[model samples]
Target chain A: MRRNRALLILLAVAFGAAFLKAGSFPGVAAFVPAPATHIAATTAHVESRFASSKLHTQVHAASAIELKDGTVRAFWFSGSREGAADVTIHSAVFDPQLGRWGKETVVASRESTQHGLHRYVSKVGNPVPARTADGRLWLYYVTVSLGGWAGSSITAISSDDEGLSWSAPRRLITSPFANISTLVKGAPFLYADGTLGLPVYHESFSKFAELLRLDRHGTVIDKQRLAAGGQGSLQPVLLVQDAQRATVLTRYSGSEAPRRARTMSTQDGGQHWSAPVASALPNPDAALSAVVLADGRWLAALNNQQAGRDSLSLMLSADQGASWRVVQVLEDQRGQAAACEPRIDAALRQSDLAVAHAAPEVYAGYRDSARVKVQSGGACNFEFSYPYLIQTRAGDFHLLYTWNRVFIKHLHFDTAWIEQRLREAAP
Target chain B: MMAYTDLTGLAGVAFALGVMLSRLPLISRFAVARSWLVAGIMALALLPVSDLSLAGYVRGVSGDLSVTSLLLLGLTLLSRAHPQRQGLLLLVAGAALALYPAAMGLGSFDPYRLGYGGYAALAALLLLALWHWVRGNGLIVLGLALAVSAWALGGYESANLWDYLIDPWVAIHALFALGRAGLAALKRRGGAR
Candidate 1:
């Protein structure tokens, strides 16, 4: 009886604790946010600039935010090459008035990351920087201590003075399976309650996207899967329609043919999501970004090709995300544009004059910096991928993406310009 | 916030490294090998390898050691008590097959994501531990109880219940041990024949 009593006590304590651990922390209903009701100064505008100057040999995955003074700060990872030891996260300020980008400087490196985290960091990449509701700038990037991208985790650091200085980096506990395989790509958005919803994805045993709801301090409070399984989606780009309605566009990685971009929407403020359905836009398994227009439409920058990322365009979706139509050919490197470089020495001019005009000297420098990355299967490739889009309070769309895996091209267009393009696409 | 994570890493590395050092011939010759092993464990935790401790580097790659893993490593430390090896091996092997391959994106359900929402899996664990406890399997019962209690206290960095229960290393070792046991059983039958 005594032995049985002791066993019962142990079991009771553990069971009681387990019941309490069921942590049904009264599902906090999604706070209804006051609709974003700011109409910016409607000036027709469109311009292009390279946010990253001759700072690093290779650069990719650029995300940007408009500062308080209206200058744009863009962040991208650069190094001798991707995954190289010298790889570091760098940023630049885009002074729209001057029509030029400030000098690029390294923000986070492997050394700084390991030092701040107090752990061994093998590499870091894919910076997703955003302004929190409380006016601080938070940068969430990918970190790996072992293996490839499959063994990745998300690390976050914040700057109170808008990218002037940073707090020590802390690893976000995203997964239970050794906290491995959570990566950031899409833009993080703010909740009505000053919390944040960071869109992340799993690349380990699966290729599904997840939404991690974090408190103000960056602690993950909840996670909701946008899709499931390897056949699901990756790199989600979110757009909010209202307090309870939101949509997510993802890179389709399905086994089936007729590969279209996958999309899902949440009706209950993201407590759950409808199954991912196929969108009309073709997805060649690449990353993309979207922003909500002042007029309530959504615009996305993506490589619209079925095979290569050689063609990038802006697609407008007037019906939330049900349909999409290309309003502008942001980049077209097909046909003659995909010509082999003439003798490696002659200045490599882009087929698109806009890109050529944006950076005549960029092509000359890219050959030496990212020679190996641009060469695919012994062919010279024109590439544009990993688009990051943000709409400033002044109703300007700032789109940034990798230019030939060497430069981060920032495209600035205003709401008036977007309206014109949308009107032209109208039937 | 990181102390619990670091402490768990330290304990795990101590047990694993201590057992490994105890196997050295020079150390094994001594009657007080364990004492020396304990001292060595402390040094390994504090001993910096490129500024971070050896244990910290291991933790960086491995993340937190699951309760099951720590318990298994501790078992290797204590002198032989192998009464429940078959049952534990079977459980580990079965869980690895169920959780890993599917969680790798093969199955419809991630089962791993079930870690964050709540501890619905704990009830089943309670039943399993109870049966094991009735059968006098203190090691398995204690491991399960401790895992639940630790997770309940919310000290772990991960909110997932599965994280506390099993990790990749423990699962892989369990499969290897089970496979070895099967081969040994086959050899015994062949010898009998």
Candidate 2:
């Protein structure tokens, strides 16, 4: 017994020495580069158009990034139905010189993704494109190998050229159990050392937000949970305040009252995070988007109501999200978007009368076109949800969202436009 | 690396399915010997099922089996060391209870994320294994040593160490065994009374 105790002590010493040698965190000589340059506002500019051409019957979860030549490329998933076997990842480019969005192109399909991953992929969705610090563009999206969305795994495909060609999809080995239920919806950001931080959520059973720190080669080095229990929040939109201080605004999925957006922050380059707390925005169980401008104000494009996506409001926070006030109603159809809402029944009848009076063929076409069924358990004629917000290097805010489940609507506005509106709504 | 992932997955599938196959009445009756039965199971594990082998399809559903799970399943099926298993099952069950709930984002701290950096969890596991070794638990020590070695080898596609250590299936198996052991102990106590 005495010799065994000594041997145990020796083993403890050996393991302790190895632990000290291995260290807690990597010796990442923190690179402190400014994230974005301050491009001045000009002429209160705002450009609005559709990012996705009317190609597939459904499109949602759009993400964008500024290219090297100052053009914008937006990415989203489209198919006859969400999670259908034919669902694919698609992208379109916005030319600043021409002031127009090009035709949408298929970036990845189910067949190509399965071929690259060497596994059977039922579907793919939520393509988020971001330019890494090394000038390579990486698109991270979710692919379901089995079951439903809860069986998701994130796959990354990169492009060396500016949104022209893509590499084969590679599945990120994230989970222990079959690598399932890890989904990506937020914009991936860069750390001081050029490492990438991808905000992802798990919906296997408990819903919670997590941040994954990846090396420059897209390998996950560390991961931190951004919420407590994580059952209440998901789809976190990341906003970096500085090199070390950053915040994440998550969509509330909890079953409690008030139904506000959840927020979690990190002060140590994501090594640790505070417990998530409810932000001052009414989430209504919808995905939202946010971006920090060069001038230090933050903008979130989200459905601000407590019930529906009939109105997407542009909310501004000057004090780094402690307080918020709606600047503009970007899309407010009131009760016009919902088929189940009793308030929209009168207008729905009038619209039906107008379509019916025009022609029988026109009424049939309108009825077919106006049919908007979302995976969120509702059929509505209009829904403005799944907004993804990003600010270009040229100081323009592009808010892209799912417009009625049929189009990815892009709302472009310059810093000048934001500044002019902020001045008008100044308290 | 992906080929290595596929190989590890195939092996895991084979052994996991091997345990199930050995229990079948036909195979058990035909092969009275366990070695022959296990060999036949390994041979049949390579049967193709579409894009993957039979084991590959099982891996497609259960993900890749952890190294510890693979080894434990192998040892219990191969070796006749039944005396050491009860302690190992209790240890695994206790660990699974600590790990699974916390890994699913039950709180602010996530134990699974430690698999990425791996220093802290590795030290903790090393000490646990050492304690078991001092207590003469050879099977538990062997399982931990094999899992850690496999993780260091990087033969599996997962970069995380937790994926090599324990999985949901192993945890569930340990829990079920522990329950059975407890129930039997209660029965014996009742019979004594």
Model 2 chain A scores worst on lDDT over the 10 consecutive residues at A343-352
- Candidate 1 DockQ category? acceptable
Tens-digit per-residue lDDT, A268-370, candidate 2: 7666677788898898989998888665678899999887887888989989998988878877776544444443333233323343465766544433443
Model 2 residue runs over 4 Å out of place are A1-41, A54-56, A336-368, A372-380, A423-427, B28-49
Q: What is the lDDT of candidate 2?
A: 0.76
Error of 1 at A89 (Å): 1.0
Q: Which stretches of candidate 1 lie over 4 Å from their true place?
A: A1-34, A68-70, A97-100, A131-136, A191-195, A337-379, A424-427, B1-4, B24-27, B117-119, B127-136, B186-193
Which candidate leads in DockQ? 1
- What DockQ do you compute for every candidate structure? 0.48, 0.43
Interface RMSD of 1: 2.5
Residues A2-23, candidate 1: write the lDDT tens digits: 6655766777797788777575
